[model samples]
Target: MALVNQTGSVFWSSNKSTTVVNTVAQLLDNGNFVLRPENDENPEKYIWQSFDHPTDTLLPEMKLVWDLKSGINRFLRSWKTNDDPATGDYAYKLDNRGFPELVIFNNETIHWRAGPWNGKRFSGVPQMKGVGIMRFELQENSDEISYSFEMLNTSLYSRLVINSSGIMQRFVWVEGAKFWNQYWYFPGDKCDNFGECGPFGICNANPAQMCNCTIGFRPKNQQAWDLRDPSDGCVRSSKLDCGSDRFLPFKNMKLPESSKAFVDQTMNLSVCGEICKKNCSCVAYANMKITQGGSGCVMWGGDLIDMRQYDDSEDGGQDLHVRVAASDLGMFSIAYE
Candidate 1:
């Protein structure tokens, strides 16, 4: 069912509702249109809400969620075109399989990823750390996992949307200019494409050769790599010696894809490293939070993917400790040393 405005545009849409007598509809201050029992003033008991079934735009205070109990996922889908409101080919959603990460999909295929939440922001989106006007939140519990943001100033308006062109963009309303200014957009560069450098490869936006193997690894197919293709990624130069392998630190790194990772929020960084060392399949580990010198633990198993290195001057990228053979440690110095 959809609510049509005076101008004939869809004001809101949701699943068809059963007819109920004496129900009341109200638009709340936070922009939620809710249906409730006439005598009930509580939001928690609302029978339905527009915010729960958003279209393309993610308004302030609107949540993109995954409800574990119901197995329902709420996400943004781009419109087919600027003039048509039909469902489009792109979607912006949260992947909660392991550690949760924001990902954009073109139909069934991944287009880009805004890596896992690292306490302050998504690990891959460094610019989010610098946005002072918006207060972001990531909530995870036994019942649900969700992400949302609200403007600090009530007078300001901003919306995050997946456009028809398949780009995720944020726009802020400019009062004086009487227009919505594009604040940010993602798939920001060639490197931002999902797994642009494939597994065990690191991408640098500023480099002429955008993709390179991590320090202790070599291109899996040098011939393909020399021809400007790196889809095959890299392989370890020396096989890990199980018990004696070292975790080589890489600073200012966009942590690898996390859907197959292991996470323990109770553990510290040092304990996290020890846990990774014990697992033969563990490829990398990093802190979950970069605040107050860092806290929590996240360890990745199997090959690492979609990793990128940011400039040293950037504020938010985290350190990733990659497992390498002891013999290979002598070849590459610890990053940032």
Candidate 2:
């Protein structure tokens, strides 16, 4: 009824008194490690398992929960050192503030984030698309808000790790190579850094000057922007005229952070536009699910932050509609019709 730590201490325990004569701990074929009586061979018949108590690594079918009312959260904290299993400063937690987003924190500061999950996938993690390895899902209902994934190909092995340095990385085990090969990592470059370009600004890793204001937007602080410091973000060139305001179709973009997002899952893309138009605070909107002709809506109520251009030929790009005045749109003005 207890799980031992590396320090030979009882780190966690069920505290259930048992008087079983013979018991055994077994690692099942489905990657579930369970504890059961020696006579019981089925995992469903087991009592405790390693999947229920996760450490730094997340395996297939394992869930990460962030409940609102109950305050029962299951998250991962990095080891104190590379070889030490003790707690560290870096942590990965499910932030359910506005919408649900997975964020890595260095102590208490936001170090990196896998942007909010649309009905399909996380906006910042498009690499999972067409991978043919995992089937990921995001569940948010009245009871609880959680993120979980299962392997599409049962033979394949993969994991997500929050390293000691506060980097979130995904790796696949290559049997022939007999090693774990990492294909993706968060904070991969300057662009992945939380709000590198501030708000209403795009971070392009390929560009010599990584940070640039979005179309119809100007630097909030021109002096700082001219000095190669764009932390002040951007400001709209023209004010929205409510009914007449048009949406600028921003393509191949990582959707902005959703802390100030107004999400309505029942609304279609057209209805989303109508509602956004009615609300003066709504600055932008996007289709949460880009697959199957697109569905659902995500509306940004305030300043949009942490948006960037993705390089994935087709899978990674999203069409974001930014509210703009008719006059500033130029040729794009006529296309709004």
Give a tens-digit lDDT track for model 1, residues 236-256.
Answer: 999788787888888888888
Give candidate 2's total backbone clashes: 0
RMSD, one per candidate, in order: 3.2, 2.9
RMSD of 1: 3.2
For 1-337, candidate 2 gives per-residue lDDT tens digits of 7779999899877655657767787787667777888887875767777776678888888888876678888888888888998998898888887767888889999888888776677777777776777889888888788887888888888898888888887899899999999978887888888898998999888768789986679999999999989888999898878888888887778888887687777678999988888898888898877777888898997888889877656456588888888778887688762
Q: Pick the candidate with the highest lDDT.
A: 1
- Model 2 Cα RMSD, Å? 2.9
Candidate 2 vs. true structure, TM-score: 0.89
TM-score of 1: 0.91
Candidate 2 lDDT at 287 equals: 82
Backbone clashes for every candidate come to 0, 0
The collision pairs in model 1 are: none
lDDT measured at residue 272 in model 1 versus the true structure, 0 to 100: 86
